[model samples]
Target: MDHRGGQVEGGTPDGESLPALLRSWRRRTNPRGIPGLATPGRRAEGLTQRDVARLTGVSERWYGALERGIEAEYSADFLDRLSSALQLSPAERRALYLKAVGRLPTLVLPPEAGMPEDVDEGLLQRFLDNQVPAPAFATDLAWNVIGHNEPLLEWFPWVTRQENQMRWVFLEPEAHEQLVNWEQDWARPFLGQLRYERARHPKNEALMRLERDILASSPAAREMWNRREVVEHSHGALRRLRLQCRRGQEVAVRIVALRPMRSDLLRVIVLMEDQRECGGA
Candidate 1:
């Protein structure tokens, strides 16, 4: 590819080109949905190249060259803007980057990577309810507690009232008392997990706000936040904590984290008793 003009020097390996994709996408876009567009007496089906260029903050000539597959250097930002102006889906956007820049955009996670906004709360609740004897709860991308079973509340009664698992872990005084090895096992890894999520989904404002609140409210969280530890998930880890139902006795459990096939953003976490440590609880 010509670095200066951002043109493709060689054909894309997938047998697709940027110009074809751009034309196809632009042709499929409806002008009526776009605000500020004059739709009367229009013979064309989709948006014109000039209209897309205007929306994308580029000159019509430049956009026309792109459509003509003229050899020119293109910046990732410009391509991203073009993708947005054309209303490309996540997959289509990826294809745009791959066809144009020879790589995928670094920051934007696919829509399927997180919980869908229209997820069925009742279904999630039922899924948790089915866990029965095992303590189970559901959390979103930001670790917000969306669903829980009675067994989970038995283990951590605070889950009944808490909205976010991360907030409760970092800010609540009860967390320190109930979590065994609070600093090393619970707080550190959990904070690292939060950091990982923040990096993975930088566009998520809630994660940023949650981090700021925890850092401001808890000295422990502030201290751990600086350590820059990173963990994706605590799945399969054996952890010991004081269960509300068991009172003074410390119970050991294995953590199981799962993402629903239908919605990757929603997490279903189940905690099973460590048979040897708790004697089947």
Candidate 2:
């Protein structure tokens, strides 16, 4: 029984209950690792509810109530504090938010974010190559073009030279002439996606560096970045491009962004001709 004479839920191996999981996590944390935490005269192993409450800036009773899965709607900030106090992993933090708030947190990126899984390089290259006439390329989380088909390299040779798609789009002078309606069709949306990715992986060094380079080098990029627009992806979006293959004629392409099951962090982008527009012409 707790101090309130209520029965404390003991965790099971399955640990489906919120209270049980919280208690289990609390017990697993090492007291010695936590800086300035007092361990003397402690009855239970790991951190006590009082310790967690103090760390999270809440009363012991309130923290206890949260652990008990009380039906109060917890704010995102409170849950964030609680997650930090418990030293929850990304997956664990997501689980805590889902259990407490009936949804995922806005800022919680999965553990796989920015980290690409190992895959057969030959197979991945073959997959891009199979796209044939369409421009197909694969990018890591930081928009670094890791792999591209012949068509992609032919159409946007800058990818081979620049390595990073974001850098080429935001910083390259040639991009303005190549991308039709550079400001509206490309820059704005691309900036939005970049902002979204940066928000997701705030600690990513390459992304931060790219952001600094673009904002510092290009006044247009600096202006667009400050617009505060955010986009997750450009999938199914119709984008126009002025390709040298077409003698500088503008062509409309439909963006198809796919995440391979084996490597969720690798984005496979294929620019397929917009059949609806093509058929109309």
Candidate 3:
């Protein structure tokens, strides 16, 4: 579906380029972020080529060659080790493997070309106004909370902090504690959305930093990243959120999303009462 200023030509989105995707991944996975042993003279927090080699029990020269995007023979064992050493989420690991072997999806931009800023703002406002009974907000392509109505902002104070959604989902302790089922309710889908974005715009520097921060802050996010699951945000998906409200009562709400007309931005996320389900007191 023409999400993100790109078209779906020949069964794929326009501007779907593999090199771009690889560059994006590289930007995100810094030397210190990967989990493994470290020694003196290491200048960065992200894993170095040597570190990856150590973790995978391979030579540093070979790993360096791989990182340079040079053509080389790689076994499944080598790929698995590299994936682990890099702490690549399942989606990331797969994308790396595909790109390394010259197998990646082709992106196609829509015939209309691109989405305008005004259109994004208009659609977001419309959704917030129309879905008054529910809490709603619009997030940018990078999952940064860009705008939201009063109700949503009230419940999620972090939204006001301008924190990236993925960071809050995985790094923030409060967020983790408040979410009903952190893994199923948030992490899984959140990572999926990140994967989709990465696939589309792999070279986005902001996106890369967000991923790095999440990895450094939360081991849970790191573990999940290694899983490499590719997922797209599904419309109409609902999740129950239990929050301690201002009225001193625990409230249970269902979260739903309203996507914009021509952008990847999720214009609004409505949180409403679940009359049939009982959890909050």
Q: Provide the TM-score for each candidate, comma-separated.
A: 0.58, 0.58, 0.53
User: Candidate 1 residues 1-281, lDDT tens each?
Assistant: 34322344336545656666777899998888788775688755899988998898899999898876666567877887887678765557667776666666653332333446667666777888988999999877877676689988878888656767888988788888889999999999988988888898887766777788899999878887899999999899999988667767888989999987776577889998887977754
Q: Residue by residue across 81-137, what tens digits does model 2's lDDT show?
A: 877767775567767877666776665432233645365557778999999989899
Model 3: residues with Cα > 4 Å off, grouped in runs: 1-116, 120-123, 246-253, 265-267, 279-281
**Model 1 regions lying over 4 Å from their true place:** 1-115, 279-281
Model 2 lDDT, residue 38, Cα? 50
Residue 174 displacement (Å), model 3: 0.7
In candidate 3, what are the lDDT values of residues 59-134, reduced to their tens digit?
9887666655466556756775665555554345546656565442121111121222445344456768677756
Clashes of each: 8, 0, 27
